[model samples]
Target: MAKLLARAGVASRREVERMIAEGRVALDGVVLDTPATILQSLNGVTVDGEPVAAPAAARLFLYHKPPGLLVTERDPGGRKTIYDQLPDDLPRLVPVGRLDLNTEGLLLMTTDGELKRQLELPATGVERAYRARAYGPITQEQLEELIHGVEIEGIRYGSINANLERRTGANVWIEMILTEGKNREVRRVLEYLGLKVSRLIRTRYGPFLLGDLAVGEIGEVKQHDVVSFRKDPTRKGGGEAPKLVEKPRPQQRGMQQIPSAPKAPIPKPQPARRITKTSANRADKAAFAEPTRQAQPGRDPVVLTKATKVKRFYDAKPKAGTGAGTEPVAPRAIAPGQRPKVFSPELGRNVRAKPGRTATPTEAAERKPAKATPRTAGKARAAPSKPARVKIHKSRTRK
Candidate 1:
């Protein structure tokens, strides 16, 4: 069946069905007439007249893929592929994910299709690091903003830890780390910020690094390291971090029993002490008590007020040219321990400037009366109490 072929790594289930329909699948030297035929074992199963091989052991390899090589197994244009650069005697391996033809660096490969699918999934929370050379004018502040994430062409990218490494005129270098491996995500995000990426190289993937690995070189991950890596979880609260693992070697001891240490018992939490109403009231009074002022010999004692009273800081220096009096304000006292129900003066703007105008407290407090102008001097005066019109008319008639 198609499931058997897929499990054997011949092709996907759907692809196996397609091959069966095309008469490419056979059993016992006879071409399969239909996909409905079932087989429990892959002993006599074949595809395209080729025998189906047994599933290979789970193996992982780290490859330093070159820039021009395609990550896929085949290219319609007959271009060079990642497999072409791999060393001989290596098993048939599948890439974890596809890297662009021009983008190069750490690329993971595995012999098991299931492992490839697990690592390739975005939910794995595997981080990919890249160093990009771009051309534009940018600052550290601008690159730091990528932490909050950015939206490009209606596609939103996850949080990126981007840092500006160096700059040479319009050309600059930046380092970026992101969890989502969206297609052309890095290039698109930089381009959105008015930067054109010239070259991009992935330096790290998860805990694996491409340190000093020459282009087209491949290396196998140690068995113990792979086990440790596979133990890591992709979701929050899934499991703990990977433990330190030693290199694999022949076992010296066999069938020996070792006991683990006994764990200590956890202590139970104690109940909190409850504060009485009278104690709470005392604490409140202590917090709100104001400073006391000693009474003068002949003057009444100043009763200090609670925290609810107004407190003002008056500047004592007078204006140089105007000679306005800058007397310090007298301290006003309220009854001791008196907590006013209304709001304090600080919260109340006593003299508010008109909207669209700004006025300081000192200017509002030191304002003076306006003086009359020359034009309004005569009009501002009162008229004569009695009119002398009758007397003036009689004198004129006599003249």
Candidate 2:
């Protein structure tokens, strides 16, 4: 089997093995049992009932990936993948490197698995250029020392080419070109230097620059360039070299011509009219037109006629001892000849006395006892009660 599929051009060799296990890959009507099984060509192998063709010639493309897209074939979380952003007409190509979900910028893609592996190898020494904005002061000395190398969390990274662009307030912008791209290397290194990377954008990968490519856009390298690049083993893959082609510069013209001033038209005079005495008198009369005929004083400013007042009926007051709030009070019904019962608002209704009986004012006043004041221990002891007497006379008679 070709290493192309194993190198991620199609799928990993392990995945191919699984496909074989699932009877998806057939060799002359026989399902392959193991990945160790080798083949000279795709001759008798078919996947999903479709014949596998020989790998196409190697091609490379520059892709501008926007943030929030993953560089994976399939995400278990159903995230949008780079394959989804690629054009439908694109041939099978794998990302030369990965950009984290939050990182966006230039990404290299290649159709040839061998070419992809060749470019991505650390031995290739391909330079990837990135612009990073960090939140902290980074002196030129520190930047220069970065080229010497920096150790982050016990991991040693090779020297990097770093240049300070500018510093505004607390943030500093830096342009970095690196040969080796470790996971979050730029961010981790800057953080070790007491700086936090606020934004990171990959502007170039090897000889290919992003160059105004809108996010999610892809552009292919000329076929001749691809062949030339492959032939030259010394070619640095990223944005380190440019072909000798004289780019035309825009031509400058002289200052714009001033426009001519427009001519102003002359005003014409009208004939004068003679004023008669009557006309003068008419003008004076019009100037003093009789003061607007004073509106005759209207019927004495309308006296609001008193409207027939409607009688408002209110609920009867609750009995005396009952609560004086809005809560309903039960009413007491008595026989016609019985004296009206005294109202007790606190009791929530009228209280009726028995026939031929009436509660005196003293009895009514004494119905409830007055609250007693707290007393001292000595005062409490002074109060005493009468004692009971024994009946000895009945016991003597019985004896």
The number of the candidate with the highest TM-score is 2
Q: Return the lDDT, model 1, position 306.
A: 72
How many pairs of residues collide in each model?
0, 14
Candidate 1 residue-wise lDDT, 1-399, digit = tens: 876666567766567789988989989889987878877788887887788886755677778877898887788999999877666566667787778989989898877667776676778887888999999898899988999999887999989999999998889999999888899999999998899999999987777778766777777776666666678834222222222222233447775555887998998998987999999999899889996777786688667887874555664445564445656555566576654344436577444323445568878766745676667755766677864444457447322
Q: After superposition, how far is residue 7 of candidate 1 from its true place, in Å?
A: 5.3
lDDT (Cα) of model 1: 0.77
The parts of candidate 2 lying over 4 Å away from their true place are: 6-9, 12-14, 233-399
lDDT of each: 0.77, 0.76
lDDT by residue (64-149, candidate 2, tens digit) is 88889998889999999988767666667778878888888988887777788777776877788899989987788888888878
Error of 2 at 125 (Å): 1.2
RMSD of each: 27.9, 25.7
